[model samples]
Target: MQLITWNTQWCRGLDGVVSAQRIVDGARAMADFDVLCLQEIAQGFDNMPGAPGDQPAELAALLPGFQVFFGAAVDEFDAQGKRQRFGNLIATRLPVARLQHHPLPWPSDPSVFSMPRMCTVVTVRDPVLGPVRIMTTHLEYYSQTQRLAQVHALRELNAEACAQAAAPPKAETEPSPFQPKLHTPHAIVCGDFNLTVSRPEALVSAPEYQAIHRAHAHGRLQDAWPLAHGDTPHAPTFRLFDRTYGPDPVTADFVFVSDSLAPRVQRVEVDLQSRASDHQPVLIAL
Candidate 1:
């Protein structure tokens, strides 16, 4: 299976053009990805830069034969009284058994501006791997306090999934909403984590990132990059040669796979030439 993750920046390119078709074109040029994960998709928000249209719907329409799931972290009424949303998206050609939207921690931090973040979890039935969880999220970019809390929340969610996988609830004879949904501990968590920084002294090097890596060592999750590339330095996925955001390039996107699927990792790569969005797309093949 091939999966691609990118932060579309509301489908705005470096040329300041917002085209959902362009986003789809860029991903297709990268690979025939079975799963596509996107962040910063806007819907019914015309005030944004470059006039992003109904991106969530547009993208879904553009990708035929794929199951599209949108998790809106920010939902509010626009000036025209229409509901507008901004968040992440997951589209897959595989069969999805279950779906859930998890709102990340967003405690108030008056000192810095922030917004609610979310993780979209989808359990897809892979022909080779069977039921596998695929989670994509965009973390809080402005506030470290909130980002740390969100990271912990993600860890807790992973633990919960693992626990459930170990002992799933008994299925009743009657079909109801109370019935447990199909899920798997084997997962692939990917997206723009917003953990890298341009400045050397920034709070991007916080211990929370290390804690996540430690979980991998404890046989829970592992970075797919290392599993595929060994100790090679990660390719820059954001702000690379794009002075509009920052002078220094850094990697803010990643793909983390459960230890159970780590060995299935065949290749991990970043598209260095595409300018479909401010960030590059990270592709992983299993």
Candidate 2:
């Protein structure tokens, strides 16, 4: 299985334009990804240029045979009386057995900072592996405080999702549209975390991120790339448009695998040249 995660910046490319087809083509050029996890997907918010449009469905329509799941982190009406939305998205070729949207802790920071963040978890039946969970999220970029809290929330959600499925051994439980069977609780969590693992001074090196690491210390959650490449530097996942490269293209995006599925993590690919969005896509194979 091949999974790709990217923050499409509302599907806007370097040309300073939002093109749905460009986003689709850029993604397809990166890899024949089985599952694509995206962040900063806009669904026609009035404040944005083309406000109140169903861009998710629009993108999905372009992809012929993929199951699309939208997690609306920011759902509200703009001043123009149009519905505006912002959130993460998961596109998969496999059959989805269940889907859930998790809203993160948003802060009331006055600074032009913390926007709403969210995560989407989907349970799907892979052709090779019977069942698996794929989660995609974008964390708070401006405020470290909110981002840290959101990290904790993410850990809790992971535990809750697994526990819900691992509750009983009954042949069949309450049939629900949002829950799935849990044979082994395999999962892949990916997206633009906005917290760089490369900088020790970064928020990811703080106690909150450490808490997330501790939760995974049991080996339940592991970063996929370092698992495959031990000594690799932060691999520069973001770049300012080709006009000029700054101090560094921050490494904020990630692809994480649960402990049970880490061993099968075959290869990790970080396409630095993928300019479909402000951030590049991180791909993982199993």
Candidate 3:
């Protein structure tokens, strides 16, 4: 299976053009991806910079056969009753078995600006990997307090799934609404983590590292970069073409895989050339 994860910046490129078509075409050029995970998709709020509303709908229309799921981290309605949503998306060619929207922690942090964040999780039947969960999310950018809380929430989510997978509750009736769906320890979590790291290539386990953003999953999760590239430093995914965030380039995007899925990581790469969005697309093949 080949998967691509990108923070499309609401489909806005560094050149100041917001085009979902361009984002899709660019990702296609990078890899023949089976699963596409994206963060920071916007809908129905046309006021934001270059945001063409209903991006999830636009993206879904772009990929016909793929099953698409959009989880809105922020859902609001204006006085005119028009709804607006912003969050993560997952589209996969594989058979989608289950879909979930998990809202991450949004603790009060008066010191800095922040927003609600979420993880969009979809379970797909990979012919070789069997049942696999693909989780994609974007963390709070400005506040470390909120980011750390969100990180633990994600880990808790993984722990919950692991527990459910180990022992599913028995269902007394057939075709019941309460029937437990397929849950697996095999998972790939990816997106714009919005947290930077120094020497990510140096550390192998037990931490997100910098008070770190990526939760090490307590031995359950492993960064895919080191698994593929060893000690080579991570290629910067943010502020590469546009350095408004910092003077030098930094990596705020990543892909983390459960230990069970680590060996299946045949290849992991970043498309350092594309300017479709501020973030470079990260691809993993199994």
Candidate number achieving the greatest TM-score relative to the actual structure: 1
Candidate 2 residue lDDT tens string, 1-286: 8888888888877666777677778777878988888888888663565342577888789888998888989888867777778898898998887788888898677875567888898888888876888989998877778888888888777776666556744454467643445544688888887765445346446564566666542235777877888766557677644424345556778777777788888888877776667777788889
Off by over 4 Å in 2: 46-53, 169-184, 197-209, 216-219, 240-246
**Best-to-worst ranking by TM-score:** 1, 3, 2
Per-model clash counts, in order, read 0, 4, 0
State the lDDT of candidate 3 residue by residue for 88-153, as single tens digits.
999999999999999999999999988889999999999999999999999988887788788888
Clashing pairs in 3: none
Off by over 4 Å in 3: 198-207, 210-219
- Tens-digit lDDT track for model 1 on 73-163? 9999966789889999999999999999999999999998898999999999999988889999999888888888887777778878988
- Candidate 1 TM-score, true structure as reference: 0.94
Clashing pairs in 2: 44-52, 44-53, 45-51, 45-52
In model 1, the worst 10-residue window by lDDT is 198-207
lDDT of each: 0.86, 0.76, 0.85
Model 1 residue 268 CA deviation (Å) reads 0.4
Candidate 3 lDDT score at position 285: 89
Best-fitting candidate, scored by lDDT: 1
Worst 10 residues of 2 by lDDT: 240-249
Query: How many Å off is the CA of 222 in candidate 3?
Result: 0.5
